[model samples]
Target: MNGILIIAHAPLASALRQCALHVFPDAGSALAALDVEAHTPPEQTLEQARQLQQQLGMPHTLVLADLFGATPSNVAAKLVDGIHSRLLTGVNLPMLMRAICYRHESLESLVSRAMMGATQGVVSVAATAPQNQSRRTSHDQDQHDHQQ
Candidate 1:
């Protein structure tokens, strides 16, 4: 299985990891996080990331970062060699959760699934009132309601 590593600015990386774990309690072994602290040098962050990658101990890894050109992403870009691991920016809870769910798949497939989750998870909610919508019938029991 491919392991997942989250690298982002302070708090964001760990926050994403905790959210993923909340839904997947047993996934802790395959997931890791590295929060780059303020004033930390890129070289130091990269070294720390390398340690986390090693601790993940999987044949392949998928690294997620919060921003593309930020310190986290910069460290991750150097951390992955493109053979055993890959990096994806704009890490959101949806993307991390999707990656964890599909960690058993090939790395390439996992990356595709994660991207799909990230894009599909974002939507503009309608402003209609609850009273304006029709109620679900017994036949709709199998359908999942995504709204809160």
Candidate 2:
């Protein structure tokens, strides 16, 4: 499995790691995080990233950041040399879980699965309500008729 690094603002990276570990205890061995604070210097964070890559054995690690066009992502961008290191933004629990589950897959496949997982995780409650809405409406109508 390629190494997994999560970089996010403040506690987000750490929190995501913790949450992922809750689901897959063995995943803690393969994942790490760098929480970037506002005062964090770019050079220092960049060096940390370099070390993380080295720890992950480089070029085969998937670097996930919390936000695109932001500091965490900016730092993560420097790691992508296009050799084998891949960078993906918008880190979330679902994406992280998918990555952890599919780590055995090729880097490309893992990235694809993570993206799919993240995208599929987002859902609108209203969209799901319609399935049982008719029953609810019928019950309410019956109650209203009795009241009348």
Please estimate how well model 2 matches the true structure, expressed as its whole-model Cα lDDT. Answer: 0.85
Output candidate 2 Cα RMSD.
Answer: 6.0
Clashes of 1: 0
Measured against the true structure, the TM-scores of the candidates, in listed sequence, are: 0.86, 0.83
Candidate 1 positional error at 71, Å: 0.6
> What are the C-alpha RMSDs, in order, of all predicted structures?
7.1, 6.0
Q: lDDT per residue, candidate 2, 12-128, as tens digits?
A: 999999999988998776898999989989889989988877877634888999999999999999977655778999998999999999988889998999999899888755333
Q: Candidate 1: where is the Cα deviation over 4 Å?
A: 129-148
Best candidate, lDDT-wise?
A: 1
Worst lDDT run of 10 residues, candidate 1, spans 139-148
> Tens digit of lDDT per residue, candidate 1, span 1-148?
9999999999998988888888999999999999999999999999999999999899999999999999999999999988899999999988888999999999999999999989988989855437768756567656655654
List runs of model 2 lying over 4 Å from the truth.
127-148
Clashes per candidate, residues 3 or more apart or on different chains: 0, 0
